[model samples]
Structure formats: C-alpha cells, structure tokens
Target chain A: MTNENNSLAEKKTPPIYPVKTKVQVSIIFFVILGIYLFSMFWTQKEMVGGFSGAFENMFTVMEKFFPPNFGVIGAIWGPLVETIQMAIIATTIAAILTVPLAVLAARNVTTFKPLYYTTRTVLNILRTIPDLVLAVIFVGLFGIGLFPGILALVVFSLGILAKLISETIEAVDMNPLEAMRASGGNVYQVIWYALVPQVLPQFTSLVLYVFEINIRASVVLGFVGAGGIGLILNQQLGFYNYPNAMMIIVLIFAVVIIIEYISTKLREALI
Target chain B: METYSLPPKPKNSLYKKLKMIIITLLVIALYVWTFVSIDIDWGRAIERAANNFQRVIPKLFSPDWTATGEVALSMLETVFIAFAGSLMAAILAVPLAFLAAHNMMGGKIFSTIGKWILSAVRAFPDLILAILFVVAVGPNAFAGVLAIAIGSTGMLGKMFSEIIESIDMEVVQAMEANGANKIQILFYAVMPQIIPEFLSFAIYRFEVDIRASSILGIVGAGGIGTMIIFASNNRNWNEMGTILLAIIIVVTIIDFASSRIRNKIV
Candidate 1:
C-alpha cells in the first residue's frame, strides 16, 4: 500500500494550461496593460482639466444644441436630396465596377497567379485610404462639387465591394464551374452560367450593404466642400448658428436611420 | 421524322413579375432623377483637373523627407489616442453588453433599450462625434480620445452582446446545480467563455480607431489630419504625400498585428 501510494504521488498531473503558455499569456497581458497605461498618460497630458472637467464642459456644450430650429428643414431639403442621390449614383457605379475587379482578385476564378496578386494588392492599397481623404483630393482636383463627392464614394466603395465580393466568389461552389469548363464552355460562359446564379443573391445583399455605408459617407463628404448637406452643416457651424446645425444633424440622423432600415429590409429579402 | 411535342414553358408568378418590373422602373427613375438634379460645373472641373493634374499628381508622388519627424510624432499620438480610447471603450462596453445580452438580462425591456442606445451611438460618424467632443473638451487630443471611445463603444457593445448570447449555457447550469450564486456563475463560467472574444474584438476596434484617430486632427481634435488640412491649405502636395505614406504604413502594420493577435486569442 505504501509503495502504491508513492507511485501515485510521483505521477504527473496535467495542468489546465501549460507552464509555458501561462508565462506567455501573463507577459502578453502585462505588455498590453503597460501600453494602455502609457497611452492614458500621454493623451491626458494635453487635456486642460482632465476627464472630470471635460465631462462638466460637455453638459454645457450639450445645452447649445437643444431646441433644434425646424425652420431650416425646408431650406436644407435640396442638399439633403443631393446627398442621397450622390450615394445612389456612387453605389450603382461601384456595384457595376466591382464585378471585373472581384473576379480578377478571386484566386479560384482568375487562376493566373500574377493577375490575382496584382488586383489584390491594388485593392488593399485603395482600402487603406479613408473616404474623406479621397473626397478632399478629388475636391481639390475637381473644384468642389457633388461630382467629387460621388467620385470619392465610388472609389471608396469600390475597394470594399471588390474585397468582399472576391471573398464571396472564392467561397463559391467550384464544382459547377469545373463542370462547365469540362463541357467545353469558355471562361465567360462558365462564369455566366455557373457562377452568376450562385453569387447573385449575395452580390445584391452586399451592394445594399455598401449603399448603406455610402449614404453615411456621403453625408460627411460635404465637409470638404465636396457638395452635400455636410457643406451646409459646416457653414452653419462656422456662422455659429447652432440651432441650424442641430436641425441638420437631426435630419441627417433621420435620413440615415430610414435609409439603413430600408436597405436592411432589402438585404434580408435578397439573402 | 416524328414530331415531338414541346414541354410547356415555365411561367413566373404574377407577383414576382410585377415586383421585378416595379424595382427596375424605380431604379431607372432614381438614376434619371439623380442625373437631372445634380449640378456639376463640368467645364470648370475639366479645366481644374487638367491644370492641377500635372502639378498635384507629381508632387503627391514625391514626399517631403523633411517632415518625417513631425509626421512620425503625430502618428505616434494617433496610436496613443486609439489605444487609450479603445481600452476605455472595451471597459465601458461590458455593462452595456451585459445589459443588451438577452441571455444575461432578465427582461426584454432592458436589452431592447441597451440595443437602441448602441444603435443611436453608432449612427453618428466618428468625425461628427469628434467635432462635438472638440467643442465640449476644447479641441485637444482628449476630444479625439473621447470620440473614439464613444464611437467604438457602440460597435464593441453590439459585438460583445452577440458573443454573450452565443455562449454555451451548460456551464452556467452546471454551476447553478452546484449551488453557485448568480455572481459566482457569472465569474466562473461566463467570464471564462467570453473574455477571449471580448479581448479580440477590443483589439480589432483599436485597429479601426487608429484609422479613425488619424483623421480626427482635421477638426483640430488632434492627429495627423491637422497636418493634412494644413498641407492642403498650404497646397504642399509633397507634405501631403509624406503624411499619406505615414498613415498607410501605420494603418497597415496595426491591422496586421491586431489580426494576428486576435487570431491567437479567438
């Protein structure tokens, strides 16, 4: 009995986590904590009154935006409609342009390794630049109008749509495509017959999703003089007409919510 | 040759046909309305592009090396703002997530309210939030931090609640069977299940916040965007080029690192 007990005691029990893993996890946790602390310190240094004071200031600032002037709604209607139109045009253009780019980028579809890689790289670079920056650049070139705003939204949405659609394409059933190829169909025929039917619903859903994003983006594009309700809002704010700015903000909120609701419903029906 | 009878053609439902036709017409009308309503000075745009294309395009390609230090410093501030804001949001979102998670909350009312609050927060773009906070906090880096924190909280809270809802309840049931209290069950079973995903999402939000914070400086909230605005105002395309390069490199690196870390965690 004593010998058996000794052997049992000598047996190694498995741990919930290995010692090495525990050490690594602890080190990582500490590193993250350290970074967070340093960041808090650095950012707080620039604040005049710190967090408490800022909170106090926020309440006072909030008071200025209350009782939004409904009087500006009639005046702002034209620009508001323009914003929606800009989003619609951009989304339509992007959806149309995304097909070729998405196909080229999808590894399973393109087959040619260099072409796939080149398209992928270009899309990746394009996605890194923010929509507003694109708008600013386009506005600089085009001299401030709805055209630049639409162009910016198109480029921005194109990058995102291409990436998403390519992923969807890559995940598709290749068997049908292979069967079409084996039946002596050309590349376009195979894609049209086999691939299109499979991806159409998802493609429509993603386009609606991108449209929702474009609506939100187009609203802000006006800040850079790219033409939209945002330009009016910026002007109102500059003129210290908080009531008008508040009204515009409220209208934007309403339009955004309504459009998103409609888009979401449409997307649900599609997918 | 014997004549074979052709099979009957498949007929679409009347409702489906009408729906398709109506949708098509609506789309066409929308396009027509858009084209007619939009006012574009095509001649001006064309002339401006022609002249600016030569000047701006070339300068944008050749970056100003002299502004490297300033850009790097601003970029670092951008990172710091993102980190601080994301951490704040990660912590702040926990209660909201719990409130929003139907499995965790006792009634539908609180969860619905929680969800509404989150969506409301999400509707405002980060730039607009930054603008508000700049006014509130006197136009500093702190405002950017506040904006990012609030903006990220909306998304993080929503994601975290979804994660909570999807968690396995068997562990909680087992803990309850062992006579564990609500708090005990939550700490022992619930926290262990959701912590990894929560951390992963928080880190991912940090990646997004970095991109967001980089541009907040345009409103004087503080980041590389201030330099961008100044550069553009000064028409210093070379400086703009350098700033753009810095943003791209930083954003890409952060995205890569965050994704790697998130993959490891989740």
Candidate 2:
C-alpha cells in the first residue's frame, strides 16, 4: 500500500473529519447503542431466530392468503364506501382548518415569536399522537361508528396538513407581500391579495397528499372499531377468514394505487 | 404615472371561467355526498362529547401520579421496541437499497422492481403488520418489534436507495480507478458518506415507532395502549389521564433529544 500510494501521497493531503471532537462523538454513539442493545435484551422473551426464522414464519402465513375470495367483494361495498366517505369528509374539513393554522404557524407570516413557537409546539403534540391513538380515544368517547372515525381523522390530518402548508407558506416569495404592506394594505389584504396567489397551488397539493394519508390511516382506525373498510377487515381477520381478508387487502391495494397515481399526476401538473 | 392610461385588463376566457365554476360546484357536491354518507345526529354528538369532556377534563389536568412506576416500565418497553425494530430494519434495508439505487446498479428493470416492492410493503400500515405478527406470535413485545421493523423497512429501503443514487459518484469512481474490489470501494468511498444520513433517518424512524408501538398494545401487540383502553373500560378517568400524560412527556422528550442529534449529524 505504501509503494502504490507513494507518488500522490506527498502532494495530496488526506481528507479528515473534525478529529478533535471525533472521540467524544464516538463515545456518545457507543453509549446510546449499548443502552438500546441492553433494553432490547431486557424486553424480548420470545423467539425471533433472525432472518431464517422470519422467512419461515412469513412463508407459512403468506400461504394462507392465496386464491383470494373475490365473492366477498359484493358485501364489502358499504364499508368501502364508508371508508372513502370518512376520508373525504375529514380531509375537506382538515384542509379548511389547516389554512389558518398554517398561516399563523409560519414564522414570516406571524412575526410574533411566542405565537409561532406555541403553534409549533401545539402542532407537535397533535402530531405525536398517532391517528390510531386518536381513533382509540374517540371511539372510547363515542361508540364505534363513522362519526368518531371522521372526527379522529380530521384532527389527525389537521396537524400534518398545517405543518406542511406552513412550511410552504414560509418558503413563498416575500417581495409581493412586502409591496402589499408598503402600500398600506391591512394584514387580511396582504394575505388575500399577495400571499394567497403564491401559496394556493402548494396548499392544494398538500391537501391531496393529506387525503391520501387519511385513506390509509382510516383503514387502520377501523381496526379499533372506528367505521371504515378496516373495521370490516379486522372483523374478518378476527374470525380467521383469511380468504375474505385477502380480498379486502387486494381491494385496498387497488384503490390506494389508483388514488396515488391520480394525485401524483395532479401534483406534477401543479408544480 | 406609468399606468395612467389604464392598461388593458387581463382577459378571462369563458372556458376557464366555466371550468372554475364547474370545479367549485363539484367540490361542493363531493362535500355534500360525504356528509350524507356519514349520517350523524350532530346535536346529540356535540352534547355527548361535551358531557364526556366535563367528566374527563379535570382528571386530564390533574394526572394521577401514583402509576408513575408502571408508566415508566411500559415506556421503557416502547423505547426498546422502537430501537430494536428500527435497527433491525436499517440493517436489512442496506442490501435492498443497493439493488434499488440507480447509480450503483446499471439495470433499470431490477431497480424498478425493487421500487415497486418497497411501495407495496409501504402500503401495509404498521398496525396491520402488528396484527399479522400477533396472529403468528400470539401477541407480545416481539410482535410489536417485528411489525415496526417491517413497516420501517419499506420506508427506509426507499429512502436509503434515493440517498445512494444521489451521492457523489466521483469518490466511488476514483476507488474503482484504483482497482479496488466492489466491497472495498463501497466500504471506503460510500459507507463514510452514507452512514450519517442513515443514522439520522433511523433515529427519526425510532421516534415515530415509539408513538406507534404504544398503540400496538390496543391489538394485544404490547405497550401502554392497553392500559388506556382498560382504564376507559373501568371508567378510571384519572388513570387514563396519567397514561396519556406519560406518553406525551416521553414522546416530547424523545423528539427534542433526537432532533438535536439529527441537526448535529446532518
């Protein structure tokens, strides 16, 4: 190696990271890694058997999903429609609610530090609770139905939609907004005439993305007695109706694919 | 003064105007349809939710501190599940990412196939994966771990592949020019650059998994979710409040800690 590197080594300096802090960083990394390993060892009392075991279990379980019973699709119409409806309603409501929150949360728009940070922290708290947890809490409050599910979906999507739209708002060109303000425009006029035009397209796209998320999330919410196709799917799985479950999964896959394709095209058109 | 003559107003095409009107109408119709589909007694629902809040709000404000030890244990279990699962997924994702990365792999077909497979895996939500694992493993901490792993794998694989494809290829090319073997080239030229982002992503995923794993217990997958549901069943509002508070605190702490690390790394 010394013989091969002899010519260039003298002329070219070796690239190095910040070596002074390297040792400290390595120690912290190792300590964290050690803690994780220790915690996992303390927690696991079951057989994992690594990759080989995983493959075996996966294969055996997967075999039961073959030859999906398409016959059950007829009966699943109501719930499927119900799931779509839940997403539509919730997404529309969240999209509406997120507009104001996103503007308020955007640092450039709000200008006030306390208001901005508080909006961010509140958004974080809202996002940290996974949609399924929201559904669980809502379902607990009001028995299982589309109503609870819709409410959960609205709150869940609101947090994310607001966050994304706020970032978009922050990134908009500021000159127009500045011009409006310089002309003595009120806050509402500045937002409507200057800010709205720039942010509208991105807002619509984010809404679409949120809707896509809601569809997938609604399915999971159904597992916990919130109304949707997932609820039916869970019931089938609980009953050990593998063939029926397979059909529902297939239907969901198809719907998700179609919706994603359309949304992607629409987003491409917007951007 | 420049616009004193009143510049011609921008013309609005009739087609565009009609299209906008139609789109607005369609949006309204869709909203109406969604409302009709989810039939609700709104007045009753508002009354009921308000009443429930009256009973639940106080407990939420004053969490029952007695269950701190139990809450701590469950929180630990949640952290372990996220850590082990995300680590496992990160390790497994490396090879799949190599296959999917367009820069490393010349064959387009295989990369596309890899992408499609990842997307299919992604479509299956984490909870469903947990439910599937629970069916096989009889519901435990391990099942939750496995579920998180599978879900993380889908996302991590795609993200890692994108990272791999976007990396500066000059170093790798230089290593190739030096007649290094494939493994040596990857380890020497690529691994150094990719590790930081990979670590950042894994930590981010772990934070999300902690929140996710808590709810896995609702389906008997193991976490604090079962406690919340249990307290609700028993009408022990205070205990439920305590668990929710515990989750929020732990989640906030993890988010704060991880974001700091991620910022330093990236």
Candidate 3:
C-alpha cells in the first residue's frame, strides 16, 4: 500500500498556486486607507461639532429619557397587542400562500425552466423592496391603519418565507419525490406525500422566523403613521415626550427578547 | 406469547400531552397579548375602509413626475449607505470571524467571548440597531451607515465562522504537518476554500442593506425614505409616485447586478 501510494503521488503532482506577499499587502493597505479617507470626507465637518458639544447634549438627552412612565405602557397595551396580532395574521396568511409559491419556485420541484424562473424572479423582486417601504406604499393606498400593516406584512413575509421555504424544498430528499412519481402518483399527491413531509420542519421554522422579523418591522411601519405601537412611539418622539418614548422602547425590547428566546427554542425543536 | 415481544406503547404520553397543552396555551397567550397591544377597533376600521380607498386610489396609477431628480439623488444616497456599511462590515468581520472560529483559535477564551458578542449582535434586527445608533449619534445618514455596519458584522461573522468550521480539516492538517505556521495555514489552506462563499454572502448582504438604508431614512437617517415620508405626509401623491418609480428602478438595477456578480463569484 505504501509503495502504491508513493507511485501515485510521484505520478501526479499537486497543483500549486503562488501567493505574492508584497502585492497582497500593498492592496490591503490601499483598501484600508481608501476607506478611512472616504469616511472622513463623507462625515459632515460642521455637523459633528466636536466631542464637547456631544458630551454636553448627552446629559440633557438622558435627563429627558429618565423615569420612564410605566403608566403609559398599559395605555399603549391595546395598540401593542394589535401590532402582534397584525404580525400573526399576516404571517399565517403568508405562510399558507408561500406553500404553493415556494413549491413552484423550487427548481427541482417545478422542473419546467420558464415557470421556475418566473416564480423565482417574482420572489426576488418582492424581496428587493424592504418591508418598511411596502408598508409606506400600502398605507398610501389603504390609508393608515392595521389593514395596511397587515397587507405589508403579507407581501414582505411572502418574499422571505417563499425564498427560504423554496430553498428548503430544493434541498429535501429528492428520491422520495421521484419514488412517488414512479408509483403513479399525480403532481399534487407526489408533493403532498414526499416534499411536504420532508420540508415541513424547515417550513414551520422559516414561518416562525419571518414572524419574528415581521413583528420588528411592523413597529417601524407604525412609526410612519401606520397603526401600531410605532405610531404612538413616533408621536411621543415628535412631541419630545422622551419619558413616554423610553417606556415604549423598554417594553418593546423586553417583548422582542422574550419572543426571540421562545422562537429560538421552538425553531430548535422544529428543525 | 408473540404479543409479549411487541413494543410497549411510548411511555410519558401524559407528559407529552401536557407539554402540547402548555404550548397551545402559550400560543394563545401570545396572540391575545398582541391583539390587546395594538388596539384594533373592528367597527371603526370597517367604517374608515371606504374613505381610505377613496383617498389613495387616485395616487396609485398616476405618480408625480416632477420630483424624479430628488428621488434619484436619494436613491444614490441609499446605495452609498449600504455599500459603505457593507464594506466596513466585510473588513471588520474577517478577523473577528477568524478569531471566532474554534479550530483557528484552538479553544481560546477570547474566541468564546467573540462568539458570544456576535450572537448578541445578531439577535437585534438592523432597524432596531439603527434606532439605537440614531439615538446615540443623532439621526443622520452617517448613523444609518454605522447601524448597517454593526448589524452586517453580526451576520457576516456568523457566516464566516460557519464557513471556516466546514473547511476540510485535512488541508490545514497537511499545512501544519509541513511546518507551515498559523498565518501560512490560514492563507494557504483556509481562505481559498471560503473566499467565494464569503464574497457572495457579502454582496447579498449589501443588496439587503440597500433596501434597509432606504427605510432607515424614515427614522431621520438620510435616504429616499425621508422623501417618501415627505411626499406621503404632504399628500403629494405625484411626488410619492415619482419616488416609488426611482426606488423601483434603483432596486431592480442593484438586484440584477448583485445576483450576476454573486453567480460569478460563487
């Protein structure tokens, strides 16, 4: 075995790619220097107003945000609850819609080139626009309310959920899909029996993941006068009601963290 | 006699049932909490629906044509913010990722700390991070850029570490066996394998950052989102429409360019 290995090694030399040390170092130096210079130039010279001004203002800002009013939390409770419901409803709708969309988009499942490409392109375009932008547009059309928020969530989550679920679908055990097809099952039956079972865990996980993102995004949407906690938060900020804003921020942070923890645990189980 | 060999039904069925019930209740609680928080009035909502429809319909089909130039400039700012932010993230994440990788650091305490920091960073969404930075530094395009950088580092670090972890161990082993030092092993064995994936992910993140940067403007971080807010608030549907067009154009172009580049690299 040793003799054979030696002979093989001798017959076929391993490919070698030379590394140029000095050229690489110079390139790295130039890139770093360029970035530093660019950022320095871009930051407004007058706007920064040095460290002293920033330091003096910091105390004032902190003072305003102090003694967060817990009372406001209960008042905003209803809106906060609505925000989550919006996310839940939208996520559920998107998750259900994403099933057919994702299956159609998955290259392996769809088979036909044009249909696959078209579905993927649509998803890509959908994903290119941010959720906030979607909300802004929807709010313009629908007028500011929970409806706009929900519509935005549906579109936004559809983009992500579809892309993720399709990828999962593509990665599933193909042999089962083929076996079902071989057994004379129709397209729906094949997908149902084979692809659905294999990708269910990942699909559910992705849906939950999108839900988390949607919750956070909905808050931002609310800031733009679309109905939610963000709308109230924006109003407080506008009014310079820093204490109230601080309360909302704190509550949001706590809720976000808790939800993330639970979702993470659930995702682990699902996957 | 053969029945004795049959497998006993799974034990702890009661416990499983209890766990299921608990989970279902939690889901319900979560739903209830959200509903209560958002203050939805179904009756009022239904009443306002038609009025909303009347106000918004005219603006949908006919966008304002005049604000196209300003929209274009804002779009550029958005792209600039994303690019600059992602560039910073890519630069910063490289060393941090190397440090965070388990095998690279050889079970060092510093690596564990680095991993923890990255995870914490990843836990917060880019938008929330932007809000924090806007508060810290004052709201501006600069804050937006910094926010994207901070958020992107978390993701890029996570991906880079995973990439490093998945690299063929034999290559590094061979380099070590040949008396190559740590740096040599990194350059010669590790980087070549993961460079393509790293670049692709970075570009993908950049595309996402572009969209995010545009939205960050709504929070006073400078971008097209500011114009979007202005147009909407002023009830200038034409201006809003123009901005939307510009946004669509910019996004489509970037999306196409990035995908092409990613395909080439990966």
How would you class the docking of model 3? Answer: acceptable
Q: List the residue pairs that clash in candidate 1.
A: none
Report the C-alpha lDDT of model 3 over A74-96, residue by residue, as the tens digit: 79887777777888888989988
Interface RMSD of each: 1.2, 2.7, 3.3
Kindly indicate the candidate among 1 and 2 with the higher DockQ.
1
lDDT-best of 2 and 3: 2
Weakest ten-residue segment in model 3 chain A by summed lDDT: A38-47
TM-scores, all models, native as reference: 0.93, 0.89, 0.82
Those runs of model 2 whose alpha carbons end farther than 4 Å from true positions after fitting are A1-33, A46-58, A183-189, B1-29, B170-181
Which candidate would rank higher by lDDT, 1 or 3?
A: 1
List the candidate 1 regions with Cα displacement exceeding 4 Å.
Answer: A1-15, A18-20, A183-188, B1-11
lDDT to native, each model: 0.89, 0.83, 0.79
lDDT of 3 by residue, B179-262 (tens): 778888878898889988998998888887888888888887777878878877887776776776777778888888989989
The better candidate by TM-score, 1 or 2, is 1
